[model samples]
Target: MVRTRLINHPLVVGLLEIAAGEIGYEHRGMIRVLCDVEQFRQTIDLVVEGD
Candidate 1:
């Protein structure tokens, strides 16, 4: 959600938690996506549901 530099890269899929909902995966080779941290934080409460 946020434009963050991943502090950790070796995160396993199981270990890395993702919010429940649909994501627009525009590219397959896109390893990461960037968004405003503030915007993400604001919408997080409404977006984040169960894992």
Candidate 2:
């Protein structure tokens, strides 16, 4: 996976934290986050999937 610099953005970091907390310990680092302006709805879905 090509880790993007966007990973450091506050919004991305906040989303990642929420995802990590929701998924819990076992699946901590297994999830992947992607962003696409053309697919706004789907991107939001991915962000909240852990919940």
Query: Which candidate has the highest TM-score of all?
Result: 2
Clashes of each: 0, 0
Worst lDDT run of 10 residues, candidate 1, spans 12-21
lDDT of all predictions, in order shown? 0.35, 0.54
Off by over 4 Å in 2: 1-3, 28-30, 33-51
- The global Cα lDDT (0 to 1) of model 2 is 0.54
lDDT of 2 at 6: 48
Kindly list the per-residue Cα lDDT of model 1 for residues 1-51, writing each as its tens digit.
322333243232212333211243443554432445564454443334311
- Prediction 2 TM-score vs. true: 0.45
TM-score of each: 0.27, 0.45
Q: Which segments of model 1 are wrong by more than 4 Å?
A: 1-26, 29-34, 48-51
